[model samples]
Target: MNLKFYTFAKNIVKIVLSPAFRVKTIGKENFPKDGGVLICANHIENLDPPIVGITCPRDIHFMAKEEIFHLPVLKDILPRVNAFPVKRGMSDREALRTGLSLLKEGKVLGLFPEGTRSKSGELGEGLAGAGFFALRTEAKIVPCAIIGPYKLFRPLKVIYGNPIDFTEYRAKKISADEATKIIMDEIRALLSAGK
Candidate 1:
């Protein structure tokens, strides 16, 4: 989709949903202006991507499920809305390449490290993909906390924490588990703050 069209669509969604969901954002300015940025949040709702995207200062290229693209309607609409497909729970090289390419262009990439939605709102252990991306791109990961259910007029809050840089571990032989722990600790702290 054209950049202008995407912006227009994003604004419309934000105008509509923000009020309905009673969405509130904190620490949005914590997102830096440039570089390959990663917005890492625990998934709580299926709408989390757009929920976070709407209030973001920069355009977010979210890593959506590959299955979504197979859907007749979303297949055409997702990419236009800045969502790229990724095979969940698999080492998808094609998706990796797509993610790296976008980051190389200095764009913000939205990732839900928890891999899937925590319907009960309890965060799960994060997948390794987020750590791998941080290692590969040397991107700053912004720990985000999204609190509250998606109910009509119920306040849902999204908090953006300070950026995390794992540059020190980039060239090191750190295990994915270790990287995940490091990343998740920051995320846990963010989540705890919202309580």
Candidate 2:
């Protein structure tokens, strides 16, 4: 998406959603202003990505679900806001390449480690693909906690934790699941913070 369009779209959506949802955000400074960074969070609802994106003053190249792309209006609107589709279950090399490309260009990539929305609003185990990105790239990984089911006119919170340092994990012989677990644990901690 072009910078001009993104800025306009972002501002318009923020204006509408912020007040309507009463979205509360903490740890906005957790996001690095310069260079590439990965924003990893638990999936609460389809709106989680936009909530996180607008809350943090950064342009996020979100790895969105493929099903949403099938939606007529959203399919077009989401990409305009820097969102790309990802086939959830199996590996989608195209999505991975797009994420890598965005990272290489020193852009922020937003993704959900859980790979799908949590129906019960509970945290669950993460998929290894999120770990794979963190382990392979030098980009910082920010664990974000999204609380609430994002009902209209309801309270929704997006709490961001400090970036997880994975330099050691990248150097070690850690399995994908182990690496995923390591990342997910931080997100879990963020969810439990100040509780």
Candidate 3:
């Protein structure tokens, strides 16, 4: 359950499972090594988080939905792997607190800015949660996208985009909804660029 050991285990899972799914990645260098970086990625597969986490050089804590947290074995393992539950459609305050706390601790936090996986493989509008967290915490926002409605043996590519500083937006007192839209637009651009 230790952070290091959990990371090691997750890496092993990625190695063994990824090849079966043919997951590939590009733009890995965009991931920041230190500090509170908010990695806002589009969800493609259940494998998305582990793929990003294992590929990223830093240990990242992800915000998972509450349902996953209640699962017996997953509950035990996910927290160890640095994932905490966010009650969907409910109070996002807990998620914000946990995310900001991790950033304050100089760690990376992973989130799905789109909120849910796109069953159509098309990008969705950004959720205000991701932007609010980044703006309030002053964490750098790293736009990310995963291409491919990944299937067994199908090729997948996870793209990490450049960091977006929210300082100017913060200075302007931009609304979280507006900030999220901007952040997601950046992510959409990166996703398109990769293709």
Candidate 4:
């Protein structure tokens, strides 16, 4: 990942967003200082990624939708900012491989397990992709919740929960769907507490 660009972009985002919205973060101590980590959050608005990225203590490598990468300026800027394209609505093996590779390199990956943004701002069902990654690698899974509406000047909070260890589940050889449920349940709890 481009550390310099990521830092620059993160700083810019903080400056731009801090005044426009009432942003707050909790449970920052839960974030691991080193090693591969998976940050699974609820997809609310398009700005969710940046909000999470700025609040996070570590740099995040986000898996954005493939369509956004084809856009005019974002196409060139996305990768430089540590954002990668992921083909949604299907099993894109290449994208999966890229995510796996990043985890193997001890990078932090930001994923919205619901696949797409919730129009009504409610959390959606978690997909198997995140579970697949968590099961395949020894990455610490951190359940995050981006709470509150996107309205200007509204109080928006991003809460990071404790890291989830899947060693027993992995040893038990649980299905991806089952693992996803466990992850989603933790996210649901965080969202509830945030509210």
Q: Per-candidate TM vs. native?
A: 0.95, 0.93, 0.94, 0.98
Order the candidates by lDDT, highest first.
4, 1, 2, 3
* lDDT for 82 (candidate 1): 86
- Give the per-residue lDDT digits (tens) of candidate 4, residues 38-121: 999999998999999999999899999999999999999899988899898899998999999999999999999999989888
Most TM-score-accurate candidate: 4
| Residue-level error in angstroms, candidate 4, position 183 | 0.8
**Candidate 3 regions with alpha-carbon error over 4 angstroms:** none
- Candidate 1: list runs displaced more than 4 Å: none
Q: Rank by TM-score, highest first.
A: 4, 1, 3, 2
For model 4 the local lDDT of residue 99 reads: 93
Clashes of each: 0, 0, 0, 0
Best by lDDT: 4
Q: Which is the winner by lDDT between candidate 2 and candidate 3? A: 2
Clashing pairs in 3: none
lDDT of 2 by residue, 62-157 (tens): 888889898989877877888898887789999999988888788999888888889888888899888888876788889899888568898888
Q: 1-195 in candidate 1: lDDT tens per residue? A: 457767988999999999999999999889989988988898988888888989889999999988889999889878887888888878999988988888878888999988888867888998888887787786788888888788999999999999986877877868776787788888888879887
Off by over 4 Å in 4: none
Candidate 3 residue lDDT tens string, 1-195: 477787688779887867976877777887777778889988766778888886677888889999988888998888788888898877678778888899888889999987788888888887889878877886888888888856779877888887897888999998989989998898889888988
Cα displacement (angstroms), candidate 4, residue 76, comes to: 0.9
Q: Model 2 misses residue 1 by how many Å?
A: 6.1
